[model samples]
Target chain A: MSDTETLTRLSTADADGESVTLTVNGERHALRLAPWVTLLDLLRERLHLTGTKKGCDHGQCGACTVLVDGVRMNSCLQLAVMRDGCEITTVEGLAEGGRLHPVQEAFIEQDAFQCGYCTPGQICSAVGLIREGHAHTAEEIRELMSGNLCRCGAYTNIVAAIEQAMGEQAMGEQPAARGDGR
Target chain B: MNRFGYSRAGDVAGAVRERAANGAAAFIAGGTNLVDLMKENVARPERLIDVTRLPLRGIEEREGGLRLGALATNAEVAYDERVRARYPLLSSAILAGASPQLRNAATTGGNLLQRTRCYYFYDTATPCNKREPGSGCPAREGVNRIHAILGTSEHCIAVHPSDMCVAMAALDATVRVTGEGGERAIPFAEFHRLPGDTPEIDTNLGRDELVTAVDLPAESFPTHYTYLKLRDRLSYAFALVSVAVAMELDGGTIREARLALGGVAHKPWRDREAEALLRGQAPSPELFARVSDATLRDARGFGGNDFKIGLARQAIRRALSQAAAGTPQSQTDKRVQ
Candidate 1:
């Protein structure tokens, strides 16, 4: 069948024919991606930002958590093409000028992980949880961060780290100081 | 995921037109459920029409009511101050479901349209009447601890897996949609149909039509309402048997009541007659138990889910009593009062 026989007569592209622009960690990357290429794949494979881990690939597990436009999202569930012209921040971009982010420093101070496989997602999700300004207590932080599961059973420390960061960040810390971690 | 054509529609009209042009085309809003289904090979759409960029993200107030755009994210809806104050049931229900990340991406329309979490339906190797018409339902005889108890048919026993939809049914929201010919509003009660002979068709929504927005009526029953969701785990899990109750209490009597259940049937299960049982009645544990029993009078559960019948009865009574006492279940704390 000819291409006209199909419904894609508009400015449409075939699976691998689409081109999109995404700004990641203050770096702009114009990529020609297939419709099936997930944002997690684009970050890990093409852009070589391997910080975002892919766990269930489905939204069930939040291992591929990343900040999309200042909001935490499962990168594996989002197609890279759908995020055109959007800003993204990953775990690798969480440190600024060789200094760890507040969440990261708190994680270290709290010893928030055992195996450390889920650290990236936990930290990223904590950063977003703090930015969302909803979790004011340890219980609230644990509830909001329920998406990212730690198989190493580091939830207690993880919640402690988040509580410390939230307390410290709440003490007159400028909002602008956050997310510049990259 | 299979290779599929991709296009971003600038407007809702363009989206409806393009999707209508292709029979197998699908609209991706949050990609929270659809993307996961695609990865599992449960859904194989030939093309994806990206409606994320459509200019339909407004959350407007309509006199005493509220109009939520189809593109509004679940997180946005759950955290909206108006929704939290007036429609707290909806906020708590939405928070009771998926995690924060999934909520940030899921949309209002997509949440209503999410496929069932039936294990048989997701496993392509198994035969599912819902996935393929006339195909045998394995869940009916297999592990059905999470299957429906009220609206089960010989062909299917899958339940509609959405906590937000349960609250919407209790709120009496209306779904506004548009098609090639024109537009029309469907009452929330009539939008989702029972799976009688055709389990393949989940709702009354036409394949060619597109849901534009959802409108909630003025009577929110904000003062007396609670969304109690019981699941396998505390968070990031679907409901085992959830209840949403909204009642208007005058002193100790119930003037108006709207009750709905999730993880119990094809749609948010509700019995108008059962709800009528609560009207003009004094609130008591005995009265609430009678209402719960009457609500589940015809509820028959499979072997694996027979325990759900008793569980549903208790959940309904607890939810009703909570609503009557004006102490709604806290979504963040997850501790029963």
Candidate 2:
């Protein structure tokens, strides 16, 4: 997006006059935001990044989940001013050069999502889950992913996709496949 | 959705001073609760004092006992080896709450300071005395299934919404606070206040004060600890009725007992009467029943929550019996040690 468009979206004047410069998807943007404006609204309305959805507005729903410094947090529960100078990776930033992230690819391969409204949040949340090294066992995965609610009941497939992704990543680190059946 | 100003605090004292300067300033920690409240228009602060970067993050074995920093996340507190070993009840309580993502975002101090999960309190349309003073508590006349039965007054019935706090009360924990007058230690039992005439005041904390840490006292009790929570759903749902109990059994008799209940009170309801009844008494089904009965003496439930009193008593009984049965001696005898 252009700088003029970004400035046009953040039209509201700061009541207390404080400037917040935050990094979004490798782009640094400065905006004057109120202390009360949440990160969810800032990303969606200000930056025009509609990948993040607002489900409950409360922290009970994981629909507004995003990675703040590679850690998953409810964007609705965080103020935009609190994220100043913090590295925020949203669902829009997951893919690199038109290539899908491994978790996104696995999700598609395993048919892990049904009603895809929660898929972006789930994918972002899953990336954070793997980054935090919380997918050791099915129980641990279930516990870690408990925050991201999938109303479609696609949990079995989601867990399978994460497991597959972890396995593939592990295999990529090893030597190339050999023909030896031993 | 109202606009509010923001500022960053250099330290605890600076935050307190900022709060004091800004009449309606609120301290923002993990932003797990405060920001949500702001969006709902339930909490309106003119200025938000960010103290997340302050050096208030540590879990140390102190002289008196365990000192848990206010910024210590729920995940950190629950998974800390020292906390898991020394205060297993506390660890268990933290793990039993919310979920991994929430626990990761939630801080110990934030958990303690979180407002009641009472549905009426959240809905601005409803008349909640806790939210708006003299608005009249709608839960009193409306659906009060999850409201408090203990530590409640005629004005309010909202139950305290933390599971970890229940265990802390049983452990006799102390909360360290820093404000205008410097540092002060408040007993956990006194940290949270019963809803007497002023149900709006959930705690004894001053408006400018910030909770720096929670101190768990070192008590010598070879007790079996248990935290039992009964809820409608398996996860995420707050407890319908919960009990945190620690009992030291001598042979078949109870040597010492500590009991605190959640989802039934404005604070962690410690049943000293039940403790007195169980001390030096034989551990039996009848004794457990008696101990449980004594805990709910003044319980006056609303229309929807009439069954909670019975549910809580039964939960306490079952927890006590299970705790007594799961003693080390029983484990040793079963393993032929």
Candidate 3:
């Protein structure tokens, strides 16, 4: 086949699209997108919920971390079409009506961010970490939260904020943790 | 990434049908490695059959052993009480791998099928025999510090990038898979293949086969097991040379032993002869040294990875000593620099 024929064939092959419904941040959204669109792009571009940052489009950096069914995952690695009918909680869903989530508040209190680009993913991941019940000590928190990279060297404060949030959750001072109690 | 048709498989038969219908179709679960490769244009599937929602997420006891469903997430398996209690080496190996978020999204089957992290394979501009067969392997003579030292071929030198599979190889696990031909059980040692003339073939599974679960035999190394991983960083880095040692000791003598090494081969390197040599022998530094030397006897490094031969030797000794002492590394433990 000629180059033009090959290009035409590829374009026609790529035209396959799918419609999906996602329950995002307590709201429902119906969208028609290509199958290759990642969950990160769907949140930032289609839904216009730009709170979740995209550092690396691959799974290397955790800037695109989000809670899928209350479990933290790298949204960049998840295809939007595959996540249909699933509940997604991005960084935008962490706060209540004009009130910051405990993890978000702790991030501020502990000065957990410098450039603030990775703050949203960090806070959301911290909330998921607390719900997972894995981070008991500061070192364990650091090891568990290693996915969300903060290039500004705010790891010390990030661990502190997660620990503080865990303390509040244990004391029942914060609202009930997110997710379906998995 | 190239566009692809998406279809969710409702069952194992549905997944197998979708995969067998079109040779270009791919089964996607967890999408951790596949999505990355797609973005790099290393893999371009015309159809993606999502199998995440399939009823293969069970982690139950079967025939006095444990059966882990294909869709069971890495975090679920690593944090499982039964897995930690009975197979602590598997738990340690899983936790020592990727970060918490990636582990939450990555599944057991996906982890087994993860591709190599070779620089040339990801760069479409370069020649990679694994990515494009017969294209010539640039990594054979290029910067190959992360390449394989054992079970390598002239066509490819990329090492398999998985810490979990190393432990599975040591645990003597069995992989349960379903294909158009029907269901079959594959020994974990035979699941992954070494780089031969056909560098493109990674595993023994057929093109249309779907892994259902991994079964662990009813055996426990309660008192002696260790997964020692040496990496460039303390967290979120691939292994430089990792060793998984699981042995059952009676007082000071080794009753049974299983040894495997990662980051130094195309597949998990298992030394059955070396393991058998340790049987009924008393645990001592000199005995560990002899075993390590025997394991690395035929290891040959290209250029940049000559240090791995010595590094793997030391790691074998350290891991054996730790396992013998009943102080296996845990998630909370710091790097043993």
Q: Each prediction's DockQ?
A: 0.51, 0.37, 0.51
Docking class of 2: acceptable
Off by over 4 Å in 2: A1-9, A14-17, A96-98, A169-182, B220-223, B249-253, B327-337
Cα lDDT for residue B240, model 2?
A: 88
lDDT of 3: 0.88
Return model 1's CA RMSD, one decimal.
4.9
Candidate 1 lDDT tens digits, B1-337: 6669899989888899998899999999999999999988888999999999987778899869899999899999999999999999999999998999999999999998999999999998999989988889999889999999997899999999999999999999999998887799999999987888899888898887888899999999888999999989988889989999999988778999999999999999999999999999999999999999999999998899998999999999999999999999998889877
Ranking by lDDT: 1, 3, 2
Error of model 2, residue B46, in angstroms = 1.6
**Candidate 2 chain A least-lDDT 10 residues:** A173-182
| lDDT, candidate 2, B1-337, per-residue tens | 5666677889787898988777788888887877777767888887778888889889988885889999999988987888877777788778778866678778989999988988988899988888988989889889988988887888899999899999898888899999898899998889998888788889999988999999988772334877787888656678888888877777878888888899999998997877899889888889888888889988889889989998988888887876676632121011211
Model 2 Cα displacement at B262 (Å)? 0.7
DockQ of 3: 0.51
Task: Provide the RMSD of all predictions against the true structure, rounded to 1 decimal.
Answer: 4.9, 5.2, 4.6
Off by over 4 Å in 3: A1-16, A174-182
How far residue A150's Cα lies from its native spot in candidate 2, in Å, is: 2.3
